[model samples]
Target chain A: MKQSITLGSVTRFIGLAGFLETIKNVFTGKLDKEDFKNIFRKVIMPLASVLLFFAVWYLSANKLHEIEADHLINKALVEQGPAEAEKLRACIASGDKSCQPNALPSPVQVWGAYQTLLADHYVISADKKAFKKKTASLNAKRIANGEKPITYTGRPSFVDQIFTSIITVFAGFLLALFIAVPIGIVIGLSHTLRSSVNWLIQIFKPVSPVVWFLLVFMIVKTFTKNSSSDSAFIICFISVGLCSMWATLVNTAMGVSSVDKDYINVAKVLKLGPMQKVFKVILPSSLPLIFTGLRITLSVAWMVLIAIELLAQSPGLGLFVWEEFQNGANDSNSKIIAAMFVIGLIGFMLDRIMLTIQKMVSFNKND
Target chain B: MSYLELKNIYKTYGEGDNTTEVLYNINLTIEEGEFVAIVGFTGSGKTTLVNLINGLLEPTKGEVLFKGEPIVGTSHERGVIFQNYSLLPWLTVGQNVYMAVKEAFPKKSKSELNTIVSEYVAMVNLSHAINKRPKELSGGMRQRVAVARALAMKPEMIIMDEPLGALDALTRVNLQDEILNIWGKEKRTALLITNDVDEGIYMADRIIPLRPGPNATLGPEFKIDIERPRDKTEMNDNPNFKKTRNAIIEYLMEIGNERKSEVQKEYILPDLAPKSFVW
Candidate 1:
């Protein structure tokens, strides 16, 4: 059904075409093998590496599940009650089949338990009859405990906790930004002010956020006789925000002040107004250092936030870990491990987001 | 009447224990549309004089007058091209030029400003690199961008501080011609500070050599009566050009030789216990 050229003919045609193209490119002085190599190395290799890493992770996860099941079985057997242990000992000594220890749950069994918990806590019941009965029972129990009947069905979920932490972080970060940047500008612009403020910044910069949180907690306690949990959280947030804002302020000011005098002279020659000079010349010139300071401030803020939460019992991922550690649940280790993983992932994502923003705003000519 | 005048200019650094004079009783006049090159050895206060006129630094005594009016500080009317290309690395060549154009013509339409910028950029033969930032450019290209930027403003006078001094020999020569071509067409007043006598003779209508210092002053001024669109090869052949170039070179050589002896004569050890009397 098809008319095909011989392999020799096709090869000859392609070779002739390639040779002509090469000749044309060479004459035009556009023969650039390096450009092609650069594209492959910078773009293609990185993408392939990422895909390969994920493939390895997926395969390993399956293998890890099997190992985890065996470990859990051994752990449960070791943790069996004294009565069960004695029975197992007697069974082994007397060679009897009657006194056997209960079999440990399999990986599927634990997964089923997790699913059941998710369903019970998360899924909304479609059956009105069952929902009404559950609500009535819950309300009766609250009333019997000398409290008003709790009608609200909404409960704070893990996702809600994440949102809370994000909102709090952003709020604190924005407040820090609003306060720090201008202060930094002023400090940076004036040598006298910078010298005077240097001591104050040095004193506060090294002080731990945990100490600040405690100090704030005490202040809040004195100010409000019965402080709400939100009050404590806010105090902690402010403590972390204020304590960690110094680096950004100092760096920004220094960056601004250290802008090359030549650039300023150029601005003067151009007769650029104050706003134009600041925004167009000074700020853009000092951006690399400013972004460096911002990255440091943001990461420091995260560290301080976690420290504050752990110390002050503030509601955040830090608090979640603290509470889980205190609860001593059977799977407390896993929960702690999971929360740590989440924290690290969130921190990494936050840094990546900041890096993206830095890339977006950076005006470095070479870049 | 001079287009620009410097009267009895004096500049001093420090006071009391550290008092030092840098410029003393300097007086000069430049005509309208004149290209004046101030030739000097390093630290001869040539840069200081230009800075004073540009109002970057104030003179201790005397005034700089432009159009018979006292110069106060930096203004859009006096554009300056620095030896080091001062184009903001953040901005592209066209953008850098456009910034000055926009500042000079704040109310002009965007299209009009854009056209002016492109024209100036093309004048410097940098239209191809218009969208490239300073770091993406070679030193010569960056200086060309700086030239484009300064010219785009259409200032009454452009002060260049050894603008082509940092370039390679060929690039320097090419840019010198390009600058002259642009200056001839625009006929704007320009003051250049350079150490090269040939460069001074090639570009300027007149060359003023500044004597060496503690108190450096302007020596003699040589009027270059050569016609424009000068061929470098032919100019070298001209008797007048040869005589002027030789005279400037001779004066500089004499000063240099005198300085060498003066240094030898003035040389003295610190009298530090006769080298510690090492036995």
Candidate 2:
């Protein structure tokens, strides 16, 4: 019990000095027993679990290797007699064509795949820079002769694709915010309007992003048939925006309509003008629900963007994953796994950002 | 002209079969600087009466007039203190008051606006909690903020709709005195609505009873003729306070019984027309 109390005091101190505790946990420095225990529990234990996970992954990967080697040997032996099989075995031993690639890459092989992708990105970016410079000079010459400046079209790298995905989702989210908020307020204020809008909302809210993309792609196809460059970007984002806006529209309407009658009475008592009533009483009171809607819509926008990008054949992470999967090369499978983690991490970071904003704007402490 | 008048005001809620006639023929007039309290039982259309005066709800018949002009819609000239203390939960007490202050005096500098908000907040003795939100405050403190917010608007008339009804007994008395003190200072054309008879007597120069509803109307008026700075303990011993309290209580009890024995079956519809025309 005494030791528990000592550890508790040390933890309380660590909570106050968070960054200092992190540094202390990392270094082989002198400390009291309780303080050391606090640091171990607070930071080191979580890292230890991650390390344990990797160890299990490594062991499982070695088992996959054994299975692959056995399969390869069986395939060679069944296809040939003893003399031919012995020759094939010699080739397999020397790492020839008969040997099957490891089905599950070990942690280190996955690391290698990641490094290769990074190096490829670096090379492609340098090429893109040189291409831009050449295009600039060519365009400048053309402009001097009163001709139109040519646009440079270069293949996007993996990192460039990730950036494209982020920007596309943002464009979609901003558009959703713009379309849903005013519409929600209108529907919320008038009962007849809300009832009329309810039918459309219910019908469209359940439609998949893929179908939305298909519908948008059909319309955009004719308009961009003559100049198709980068029209996929517009089509992809518009589809994402349309598919993700339902949550915000529904939530905003509920928030506005359910604003306390007392606040409305207060607005009336103050005799605020229409604009002031909306800005002062209605918007401020309903902000918590609106922020919640925005957060959900943002995450939805990101989730739909990947599918939209694939449908549109746009330069984004979704295309990267699809292309790498179709390649089915030795390193390509591992690269796809890496892309999965990157997608998950970006989604997680976006959620954390929205959560922080929600916390900042919320009036209720518990929420 | 009377400072404020409800000319044969009538109000009904809902449409068709769902209609509830909450207020009927509520004719009232208050001269400038007069403090009038409309006392009633719960659900007695006191709030509806206040709404009519503030122009929140239009009268089904007749009108609510302010300074000889019929009230069309809500205006800043008539400030309102609602029963729920409708301070926006998101705004700090000072900011809540500032919203009203800024609306009333749009051209005031920010510093001037802040000064007015803080001044009224201080009047309610909530200076320490000026920067705090309404949700953080107690029931009484929240009501004080409401009172301060209404007063800060500096409107010509202030309409309070059951403002102190939700407070505890002790807090109710304290607030009543604080409100009376504030009203005594500038003497704005004030209207207080309450269910408690003593509260009305304590706060107003004249008390009017609203008879119970389904078509509630104003009953007889009773003047609270007690002198200024009246003490609760001292009022008990004073003969006039007892006389006025007894008369109002007697009237309310009589109505309470009258409302209970509604005679619904006897008068709902005529059993047979008083003529042979139906044959």
Query: Cα RMSD (Å) per model?
Result: 10.5, 8.3
Number of the top TM-score candidate? 2
Question: Where does model 2 sit among the CAPRI classes?
Answer: medium
- Per-residue lDDT tens digits for candidate 1, residues A91-141, read 545634243222323344335444543454355333434666778988888
Off by over 4 Å in 2: A1-98, A101-109, A123-155, B1-3, B7-10, B24-27, B61-69, B105-119, B126-132, B168-171, B250-279
Residue A82 of model 1, lDDT score: 58
Pairs with steric clashes in candidate 1: none
Clashing residue pairs in all predictions, respectively, total 0, 0
Q: What is the lDDT of residue A203 in candidate 1?
A: 88
Question: How high is each candidate's TM-score?
Answer: 0.75, 0.80
lDDT (Cα, tens digit) per residue for candidate 2, span B1-279:
888888888889999999999988888999999999999999888888888888888899987889999998888888899998988988999999999999899999999999999899999999999988888899999999999999999988888999988999999989988988988898888999999899888878999999999799999899988999889999999999999999999999999988777754365565785666755
True contacts kept of each: 0.76, 0.85
Top DockQ hit: 1
lDDT of 1 by residue, B20-59 (tens): 8888888899999999999999887777888899989999
